[model samples]
Target chain A: MAKDTMIEELLDAWEETYKKGQLTFWVFLALKESNKCMEEIKEFVERASDGTMTCEEQSLYRNLRKFQNLDIVAYDSRKVSKGPDRKYYYLTTTGEELFKRFVERNIMIFTKESIINLLTQ
Target chain B: MRVFTQRLGQFAISALIFTVAFRYALDLSVGMKSFPAALVCSIVYFGLMFFAGWYYGSKDAVENEIHDIGFRFHFITYVLCIALGYASYFIGWNTEPLRSLNIGAMSWGIGLALHFVFFLFAQKNAIRGYVKEEIFQ
Candidate 1:
């Protein structure tokens, strides 16, 4: 499919996951800044929430780290800084593909029944 | 309710222990001779706990309480102990020994040892009743 179409589908999937408590808004934001480094990530996080995150938000970030399809990295940005000044990131091909698929599927799976079932089970 | 209060009390005790260790290891007194930096550090430590308690106390009734109390105790005690060690080094920068190896060793050793003990205890107790209920029901 077209890249735009794929991106939309991934976004739709993300929205569904978010409603189902599988994904969080902060994860989406981090995914948006997949190309940025550690410092950039920090800046993005700070800016996104007006300089602070609650414990839940922090926990969500931790959960995002466990997603098998995502490949966040921390490497030295040769374009920006030299040795000893590395940057962190989270933009791998697998992450990109997963996100695309998520958006394209447009699965309407985040219903109250599904959520209750998940919580009870 | 009892568990919540007990955990809070434990956190308070740990904080007090850390504060005492910090003051002694760093020669910080509360009188007129006390350094402004020491006062600021103490305030910041308590302030952090206050905010942490308020925030976590209101989140998920069970999860937040456990996390908040656990995090405050561990984080404050560890940070204060390390800060005291580092501050001792900076203060004694021009002295004969140049640093208080004894203070650093004691602070780090006690802080880390106690942290591990408390961590294990908390983990063991985290889901005791809840897990049983969930499993049986």
Candidate 2:
């Protein structure tokens, strides 16, 4: 596949997810910036929801709480602030490494056809 | 219910927050006040309100239109109050010794109180509408 084709596919997927109103984009974007505490994540979620997150939306956030549940993400209550006990999540080293790989792979797959055609002709 | 009132509320809240924060940050009551400081703060606060309100308003037209309206009206009022307060502080400091401090303190107190009132009005009006829309929809 050409690099442009791969990029197009990724964008299409993103749009689809957005239309579905999934919480994944907000979570992913927030994690991209920094290792956020739970409070911080909640604030970002509230903001992204445009001050309107349905009960379902809130539940979706709760479901994202486990690392074993989603291998790419990890949560640690100990590393975060003490008092009243709250868990904080951050992308694992492997998760960060995988995200980079995912980007590179898509780019290579999309661009490969052009590169190959150029080389042969 | 009117669009103007809605917008007024938003602007009032933003202005209040900006004023209170600026006053606290500058320690205007205690410090040797500078005209430049007051002028800069007022400009920055109004500019922020305009830009933020516009950006948020564009997201969803009907909802934001009301917010923008409220914000604009409140902002104008806020600017006037701040300008008056700043001028009084400037004048007092130049004219009198101990009296200047008292005048500055009073100005800051009035500004801070006005800001708090605006905040309450904004939170009640601006956020409530959006929340209701989301819930009912």
Candidate 3:
């Protein structure tokens, strides 16, 4: 529960920090990990953080769509089984640059070791 | 919505406190009386946030927040660069000859252009409604 709250806080806390054109850092990071759809991204985040995701499925999809609008990320719909096509998303060049620049800027404060640990497992 | 807003409020308060402490310490050395305290504060704040994101991964809540804050600062800086460039041009300021060629505006405008190309134009078929296409086409 505490972890869930923390996750929620961290995700929502970023709203205050959205100055202009900026998307949430976590969303970018998640996209960078793989070119997965919303559901896959949600599951990945939960597994990565030991089921600590506090936001629901809709929020994840909403963020993805926003990223699409910003041209940071793009999606292609692949054929899924019965119901509908599954959209797979990947970071565009702009998205990659933004994420890279963001990391470079915070390299000193967040520490490489910590980031490595976080991304690796 | 309520919960999200509450969390955002908390983030704002925490950021305010951190800025105050950081500015106070920086003011001791830079002497805000002479130098532009506002400029110094903005620089230091961005420097710290950027440094944090670079050093620490956005694994936890605090680290993640720091990363996003850096993004906000960058986004704002680029916007301000373009805005102030236009402002200076219109104000008919003196220092430089070609006021039209604002370096900040030109360079940052390229950044914005790239944002449009890769993010907007990359996926040509994106705008179509998925459900609509899925059913019709």
The CAPRI classification for model 2 reads as incorrect
| TM-score attained by chain A of model 2 | 0.47
True contacts recovered per prediction: 0.00, 0.00, 0.00
The CA lDDT of each predicted structure is: 0.50, 0.55, 0.55
Best TM-score goes to which candidate?
3
Model 2 chain A: ten consecutive residues of lowest lDDT: A61-70
Determine which window of 10 residues in candidate 1 chain B has minimal summed lDDT.
Answer: B128-137
Candidate 2: stretches off by over 4 Å: A1-17, A46-58, A78-83, A101-121, B1-137
- lDDT tens digits, residue span A20-116, model 3: 2222555566788888877777777767656544346765666566557557789999997798998999999998997899788964556678777
lDDT of 2 by residue, B3-110 (tens): 444544565566566655655545563365776776676577668766756654454344332333244454455564556446545654332344655675577668
Worst 10 residues of 3 chain A by lDDT: A15-24
Candidate 3, which CAPRI tier?
Answer: incorrect
Residue-wise C-alpha lDDT for candidate 1, range A1-121, written one tens digit per residue: 9999999999888766554542334444565665555445556666776654322445543444333212432233445455665444554665566556765564435546977699789
Tens digits of per-residue lDDT for model 3 on B1-137? 01122333444444545544554544453543445665666687777645543433333223122213233333444554455445444555422234455765677778766664654343344332122122111
By descending TM-score, how would the candidates be arranged? 3, 2, 1
Tell how far residue A24 is off in model 1, in angstroms: 22
Please, what are the lDDT tens digits per residue for candidate 2 over residues A1-121?
Answer: 9999999999888866554534444565566677776567667867877855323544445435323233557876663365665556777776677556865874366568888798778
